[model samples]
Target chain A: MIQVEGLTKYYGALAAIRDLTFAIDRGEVIGFLGLNGAGKSTALRVLGCVLLPTSGRVTIDGFDVVRDPHEIRKRIGFLPDTPPLYTEMTVGAYLEFVARLRGVPSGRAKARTIEVEERTATRDVHDEVIGNLSHGFKQRIGIAQALVHNPKLLILDEPTSGLDPVQIVEMRQLIKGLKGEHTILLSSHILSEISQTCDRLLVIQGGEIVGQGSEQELATQMGSGGYLEIEIGGPSQGEGRAPVEKALQAVRAVAGVLSASVIREEAHVAQIKLDAPAALCPQVVRALVAADIDVMRVGRGSAQLESIFLKLTQTGGQPS
Target chain B: MSATFLIARRELGAYLRSMIGWVIIAGVLAVDGLLFNAFALGGGDKRSSEVLSLFFYFSSGTTMIASVLIAFRLLAEERQTGTINLLYSSPIRDGEIVLGKFLSALAFLAIVTLATGFMPMLVMIHGKVSYGHVAGGYFGLLLLGSATLAIGTFGSALTRSQVLAAILSACMVVAMLVAWLLGRITERPLSEVFSNLSLHGLHFQPFQAGIVHLRDVVYYLAVTYVALFAATRVLEARRWR
Candidate 1:
């Protein structure tokens, strides 16, 4: 568990994060979503005890970060925006060194290293020099070092940053695999990145947390309402596209259906974006299936977080 | 203390595994050997003690230079590579981190200094050499290296780039090296003050001549203390920045 209240950090006259308050429960996987300079890294650094907050209180499990940082450091593992690594060291030696530094007993250091290497799937490259490894491997080694100590919480800043698509998928899967063990709070700019791995999200903007919830909960609470995106395959065999349109129009005529627009048109699939009140999602999905339209995908709209995030940060005068 | 030694042991291994360690050792020994042959034994029949004294004289310069070179990368490289975050986020105290780095550099400098012992033995064999004199001279070399390395450690802590670290350390060493000349130009009390402040003038001369005064030992220890203390404070203040 973690508790942070009014945690404000100032870099000279500029306040990086101000009046931030949040508490994380044990075993919760939370995503920290923010635009650039949104104070995510600053907040994470304060929580990790790597940077001191100028004014506020932060405690991990019961130990105050400012007064008892060393004790807090024993309970949390931190990976900064850029994976801090020693290029000269091999992956195995580096992880083992971190394990010992985090107070793992020498007798159990190797076992702990092996445990984390396997957990992060870095065992195959254990003997390779960190400098020689690819970016993905180096990033994995960075996470491995943090996990090797087996701390209570993991604070990863931009975990999938700068990786190619494949590497990003691998890193996301690796983090997902770690969900149940550690209280993970990861930060990223990509929505899909957070949506796939995190159970809930805390969207930050301009040093303040604007929205916090699961995808649907946030869309519902923001009051801009949620939209259902249904991608249907080509027109039905004998029935024309009018049935699909009439069915959609009929669904819109249903109580919470506000409006709909076509977003994308691939060869066989047509993507539709809905702007609707929060209550009409189920009726819309049911109407499509009842009309015998082959739905390739039934999911939420893509710009749900973007709209909510921009409203919070780009507001004229929003405070924490 | 356990954390201090744990960090120190790893740092020492880093030095041994890297090419820079062997470069300093090879460079210093090769220069020492060449100087020993060119100056100490090149001329005619000199007293064994004088030849041994010359060997110590040339070795002192190289040892001081080597100390600066070896200590330049201690903290600066970590900052450059962003690896200092590991130490910053770890449970170890700031003072422990500094002592760990200082101890590692001192250990490697000791190895390099000892590698040239064969030249001293050669001086002893052909001439009438006192074992105590050689011991005293080597002691002086080590103490000088330790003081220079400590100063270099403080310099390295001030900057993030290795080039800037070396420049700062060289300037600090040169200022102290020139203090003796300043002492020569000034009046009595001020001259005496500069003389004592000169890193090698008053303190190192006694050890160079086969005598180990407690005052000289105390001065080196004091410099080491002040420099390492300053470096630790610098590391701690960085988190705030």
Candidate 2:
């Protein structure tokens, strides 16, 4: 539903975003991942038709952003990092106003407002003034306004930025529910917050797209292999270092095991790290058990994606 | 045009609901009444025509200042509060946003300006003043208010700070008000140019004297149109920045 080529934006002599190229298919939820000042907002603003790119072309649903921004505006709903809300207006009235502003006929504006309010779970506060609502409700109102007109695409910049943990979970579910009805593009600095909610991830750093793919695809591409974390207890007490050394050697001998090391040793228990695909984890565990190392726990490491993200961003996706 | 009216209606509703709008109306009316009692009606004996003219004269100052205050928040406050993104991302044109804001302020200013009609009616009650004179004076105030409000809209478009918008608008209005003074110092052709450019000195005198000139009407409208156009351009330029 969206395609961008060489999208560059410059404020005076400094470039905010440079040479950004990506395409988003219909019915897909894409997460734009970047740290603060990583040009994520600038890129999204350009795509939202709020700012014009200094160079490059962007088209949404076959309409050019620069030449046909009005057409694009009618088809896309955008919620900026700070929700564009009129504090004096009631939630219902504000949603109705936004509905009409985006070309929803006046006759149907109220119905559309109610529909969006229901979707965003803001129905109870329909009559409440926005300024009086809590931050979580205010964010929901922001999402409601974006979808009030039922646009083809939704551009949300950091939808969960200031929310508390419970609010964040609610927001995640709300966004997840929005999938299939509209193509969603949301940005976030926190990987775990958006990783599960999005179908694909676009990692950006220094105004450039360093990597793009699903979580596992990005992990496999950046990480030589998945990591395996294993915890084992020795048969006898105070045999700590000997059992850890024996388990590490046995795990390394297994085929497809790239490397192995003892992570930590305490009493008779030792934690070992193995650089091998998760599919070979069973074999590593078997080798450790056959070596008389009592297996307490065996599972895929959780830092696989985290390591990939840090590696891609720090190295700019260059070969290590 | 519907988009323009949609924005205008919302903005006007905002003005009606907020305390600042009512405060401006009350403050301007109080100041207008005080000036009428102290200056227009108080100073010794004078003809009814002179009194009405003086009323228009003082009311013009209040209208100009009130226009600046009313319009300073039109666009600047939207930017300050970050609500401008709603308008910016909508399908509406830049001209529509500018015109919608200007129209709302103009409507509010007209209501406040007309509310001071009792002062003119007081002159009509005691002495003999032509209805034409009242209408002419009011027409001039409206036109002057419209033009200054447009200038204020342009100023508001230039920055996100309402105080800065007010200052910028005051500077523009004062410059045009003092053009006649500038004309007095310069020679011949330059003086004529400056005199013709004056916002109030020459253009408003005919309306103040109970005579509506086509040229004066056109000049006020021309100023309104040009300022509104510049404000629209400023809004459009923001997208590029």
Best-fitting candidate, scored by DockQ: 2
- Give a tens-digit lDDT track for model 1, residues A1-320: 99989999899999998888888999999999988898999999888888888998898989998899899889889998878887878888888889999899999999999999998888898898888998888888889888888999999999898899999999998998888989999999888889889989988878988778887667666655776777877554565566557546756666777687777755566777777754666787777777776667777653366666666566622422
Q: Give the per-residue lDDT digits (tens) of candidate 2, residues B33-136.
A: 99999998887999999999999998999999999999999999999988898899999999999999999999999889999999999999999999999999
Which lDDT tens digits does candidate 2 get at residues A191-289?
A: 888798999999999999999998877876775667888988843665537877888889989998889887887776778888887888778888978
Best-fitting candidate, scored by lDDT: 2
Please state the CAPRI-style docking class of candidate 1.
medium
Off by over 4 Å in 2: A230-256, A262-272, A281-298, A302-305
DockQ of each: 0.57, 0.76
lDDT of 2: 0.92
Tell me the native contact fraction for each prediction.
0.62, 0.78
Instruction: Give interface RMSD, every candidate, in order.
Output: 1.2, 0.7
Every model's TM-score: 0.89, 0.93
